[model samples]
Target: MRKRAKKHNYTVIIERIREMVRENGLQPGDRLPPERVLAAAFHVSRGSLRQALQALAERHIVESRQGQGTYLLADFDSVLPGDAILEKVSEHDNVLHDIFEFRRIIEPEIAALAAQRANVATLNQLKVLVYDQQRALFNNNEVDQFDTQFHQLLVAMTGNSVIAQVMQAIQAIVDTSRAPWLQSRKRRQMSIEGHLRIIDALEKKESDGARRAMQQHLAAVEQFIFDNQ
Candidate 1:
């Protein structure tokens, strides 16, 4: 029953809502602003806003509870773009190696920048993500999403829009690369330790230490992948 003409507008609106969520620090289970307020913020009609929310609900990105507002059910990339290409690349035999190499080259620098540029708010957000990662690991639950969020948050803290968008584009590939390794508790614990080290360095504003922590973390990931293969 949806109109084809509104599809493009709906997608744009969806991305805007995602941006709002990120900018506002709305985590999973966090309620969004009221419908009229959101519509006003986005400069769209209430009807159009409802349409976009409905689309997001369909993807399980947001859920509307009775007598309450819509809440985030998952992270931003829960519904990634370019699914066809993502699937093709993720299935490639060397994808994990490629992702590891890419992260090694980029993420240490991101950590270093985060050390230099992160304000208290940014550091606090990173801390929240680290604890989220730990909780996920302790529960023996899936950590791929939290793992991806941790890395993506690092990239975002760099205050570089280009880097953030580029990382976002390839996040699904990175998630695929991380999935197999996180299946082992030992590997997950190693990752958690590495993230803690990075956080410590960032909290102290030690650029070199942050960079070193990230490098060590990625090296461990590379070693794990090498041994498993």
Candidate 2:
């Protein structure tokens, strides 16, 4: 029974370990002490301690290299925020702004391309995302993932895999920005409306209209970010 509860204790152990790492400015490739030593430090059994290490390993925070030992895999900034709490990547805030500018550059054109090239099937996929987003909002649930789905689908509609790949990379950067822009009901409503307008423009195959709608939507997003800040 004692052993059984230790499985659940990994989260706590990992939590403390992450806090220490942040305090010490631990870097990538840094090796933690062996499991037994960690167990002794934390006053937890070796079995429980190994479980904590394994959990971090799964998150790309730590890596095991067979003979050498476990190594820290996450960058210093990346590891600061553990799984339970998200933090702003303060070091890359300017990069994030640049990323949004990149969005401004790439997104409007993708929307125009979508208007021209999106097949009925691709449009239906966008519709599905909108529907899921609406359902989440109605249920008072978070719409972040669903919201991202709409943009991701729009990028795909460009019929250019390269655009999709670049958009995906941008999405990853956006995800790391810490303060979620979609946690509020008001934001979700605005996003849904924006999506609807974009979809309407795409459905009509009006390139200019689609481009305008996409640019308007992104402008609104930037305003919302500023308003919230």
Candidate 3:
């Protein structure tokens, strides 16, 4: 059908856009090429390009400003390759429990690694993300995207490709679940506070502190979700 074909085309366009980001070495907050330029380069109609952009926008991977061009909002590297781990697992499985347990086990080590490896630029970027999340909360906007960005950034700071791949799988699994849990302003504020503590530990390059902070944060998160559910 024509509709199916159009959908396929746009999906192709979206992957092409992701490839463009990789080829260009684009970073968070980097402005993408103008819409016209992108459409021309990809040999797609402007309408098709817009559809691709809209899909990215809904994922909070990118954002468009009124006068300014669209910009990358999160690291596209967080996208998993092929079918995600969750996709292969049974739907009736205790997937959420497995994910949280994995987080509690692995993420503390990630935080410690990040603390050992954090540089001035990485710290500055983390601060900016936290600030943006705070601003979003105050403005009554959803903070789940920022939350994702913050955690992804921490993973990036570790500079471990294997860890990156693992986090990407976890990200794919939780992408659908974040918004509902984050809808509560109290939850969002708590998340920000947890991020600050982790940031502080990273700034001091305290691996033990970072590990403890991450453990506490994950515990708090798991407890909150359990209480709510």
Candidate 4:
């Protein structure tokens, strides 16, 4: 859970750095503040800030010089803007619908397979993920990370590399849509409850029950996202 939380913090810091780039009119090759300054300004530990910077470096968005400091490697405008979140959703309405439709068809089957094949270790991991989701709720943090992990873990449990690849393929758009869908506390709570029910079915090793639980969960989530949109 601490690991997940730290990962979340890194993500937050990375996004904030992007925002800072745009807000401050940072250009490619422009140097960012020193690590210490950035850490203080961002109200995060230097270690956490460094992790975030390392992530950006991995993405080729920024680079750290030897004893020089970090510098922007790309323009922030090339990245998706926060304001584009809903706009992208609205623009790709049909695509989004099809994605949800695909999930509805695929994820339940995955859940069913997981119920049959999941080992004790795998089940325990899923429980920890859902528990992390509960903790995120209490901490008023985003639950989507854990939610995504839980679903992906279920796919992995199915023991089909092809199915796992398929899930990974659609992950980007799924992530885009999920951000707005999960913005509401009610929706987040609903997601947690849905995951709990699916976990219960999996724990009992009831493939049929897991299938039903997953189908119901996806249906409700899809309805809410489309209805409220």
Listed per model in order, the count of residue pairs whose N, CA or C atoms clash below 3 Å is 0, 0, 0, 0
TM-score of each: 0.57, 0.58, 0.58, 0.60
Candidate 3 per-residue C-alpha lDDT over 97-156 given as tens digits, one digit per residue, 9 for 90 to 100:
566767778889999999999999999999999999999899998677898899899999
- For model 4, name the residue pairs that clash: none
Candidate 3 local accuracy as lDDT? 0.77
Of 1 and 4, the candidate ranking higher by TM-score: 4
The positional error of residue 74 in candidate 3, measured at the CA in angstroms, is 38
Best by TM-score: 4
Which window of 10 residues has the lowest lDDT sum in candidate 3? 84-93
Tens digit of per-residue lDDT, candidate 1, span 129-177:
8788888888877776777788888888899999999888887777766
**lDDT (Cα) of model 2:** 0.71
Candidate 2 residue-wise lDDT, 20-79, digit = tens: 677777788898767667778788866556656665665577887887777888863454
| lDDT of each candidate versus the true structure | 0.75, 0.71, 0.77, 0.77
Candidate 3, position 89, lDDT: 24
**lDDT by residue (tens digit), candidate 4, 1-229:** 1111112455567667877887899999999989888889899877557756765675577899998999999875574446342233234455656777778788899999999998899999999998999999889986778888988899999999999887798789777557542246777888989999998999999999999999999888877755543
Candidate 4 colliding pairs, count: 0
Model 4: how far residue 221 lies from native, Å: 0.7
Model 2, poorest ten-residue lDDT window?
Answer: 1-10
